[model samples]
Target: MVSQSAFAFICCLSLLLTFAHCKTLKRDVKALNEIKASLGWRVVFAWVGDDPCGDGDLPPWSGVTCSSQGDYRVVTELELYAVSIVGPFPTAVTNLLDLTRLDLHNNKLTCPIPTEIGRLKRLRTLNLRWNKLQDVIPPEIGELKRLTNLYLSFNNFKWEIPKELANLPELRYLYLHENRFTGKIPAELGNLPNLRHLDVSNNHLVGTIRELIRVEGSFPSLRNLYLNNNYLTGGIPAQLANLTNLEILYLSYNKLSGTIPSGLVHISKLTYLYLTNTSKALGLMERARLSLFKHFPYQAEYHLVPYLGRPLLRTNHSATLPHLTSSRPNMWRFSLWRFFTR
Candidate 1:
């Protein structure tokens, strides 16, 4: 039984409240501006206007997204992948408290990652690959409890990988390849329950590679493991057989010794196996040849490259296992028939 004037007044107040709530905050705009300034002009362009989170139909900026936050709009995502941006990783990004995904990979960015990156607690994905970043990864990165995908590969990083990386429980993919990391692979890496892909290849890593197998029931979900071209010395642990879900394994160009554990042959899921240049790797190669030849599909590839001082096949290299070493397409055809018929 309200009057028309009273009802209209209430409706007007609701419209005013909605208008105030949809506007972008001044702090978010400031953070975005700082990030652009850090990247310089050459890489980031078309950011001339001040209203980044505009009230228009299109997005405010080139690589920015805005979302509602109480009575204000805030930046939720900032993606600048392969945009040829130069300069160091922007520290001002930490100011965007609502940011969930930050992709600045495949650019010419230089300098070490900022330590304040740990402040982005809500971040789930952070990609900074193919850059010129160097120095050791900041231990503070472990603070990203919500991080799921972390890519820092193809950089100039040196020094031992921080053990703190194991602190990220939700981490699934970790790529730190083609860097200058030294020291034993951290045993703590096995602590990651959800880890599926781990690649630390082509680095100067030293010490035995058994640390990854030390933890019981570790890496139960691991699918791909690549630790090739390191200075690793020691026997390949039989525990690797426990990773029943393992699909691709690369442990080449190392100084490892001891007979290849027969348990590895039982891993039915393993398809791509590369054990080139490791001591006594031929033992497993020869033993598993029959099983692999009979069980695996044509798509599976096994490379047992001969190293110096120990040549598995010499002089008659062209004749030895001609079917196995032939053109890849032909080999796949041969292997397919051999596996099904036998």
Candidate 2:
């Protein structure tokens, strides 16, 4: 049996250890409070406590995810997707240096992303899609060396796509479509070695696709590339056929003018191709026509037909074609069949 003084001392030490191991770091708690206050009264009701990290099993707050780091807990993820969060980007998030993912998509968040976002060096995914956020993307996003996925689509963002994004060495998926961006597509984007999917469609981008082609070994691992609904001119680069892993290509609704490249037929993995409303001068070369039929003899047929007061060449491959139709005249629609697979 222990003396009263020794028993009391043991109890006190156990209580101290419990309190130390259960509480979130003071800085992280402060940041969480600031984020809640910045988000106005629409924040989650569970955000009511001084200990947002809870008792180490789950976070007390709804959107916050915390992890243990020695004696304290730290915020690691904040996924408030489609929560109707109103107001600007929460600037306090930069304080969470250990954050690996930040998703605030499908909100009413407005204004430009703060440059302090670069402070989250451990971030691997940053998704801000389907928001009202406007203004040019900050170049500091390039500082996230571990970023693998970036989705900024369906926003009101304007101006040129930042070329600094090329600095992200591990980036894989880059989606900037359905925005109001203007200026030339950054050719530096083509040099991303690990990039798999790139979509810049439905913007005001101008200039030729030749810049991307000039970079040797561009888009080596690319599988899906979307450059539709822009003001791009010049011929389609035949070097695009070099993307052996490419499965889908969208270059429609642009001002491109040139004959279709016959080498595209050699891309055996290409399952879907779109070239609608490209230009009035765009046509399929005779070699390209023969190549298409050679690869897809049963389903591929090219012929000119009168439609919408213009002659249009349509290729029908019903087996693999999606239910897509274009009313615009002077367009070439090719529904290539995935007849061969690698």
Number of clashing residue pairs in every model?
Answer: 0, 0
Runs off by more than 4 Å, candidate 1:
1-21, 55-58, 279-305, 308-342
Compared to the true structure, candidate 1 yields what TM-score? Answer: 0.80
**lDDT tens digits by residue: candidate 2, 140-228:** 99999999999999999999999999899899999999999999888888888899999999999999888766777888889999999
Q: TM-score for every candidate vs. truth?
A: 0.80, 0.82
What's the true lDDT of residue 51 in model 1?
A: 59
Clashing pairs in 2: none
User: Model 1: per-residue lDDT, tens digit, 157-236?
Assistant: 99999999999999999999999999888988988989999999999999876776787788888999999889988887
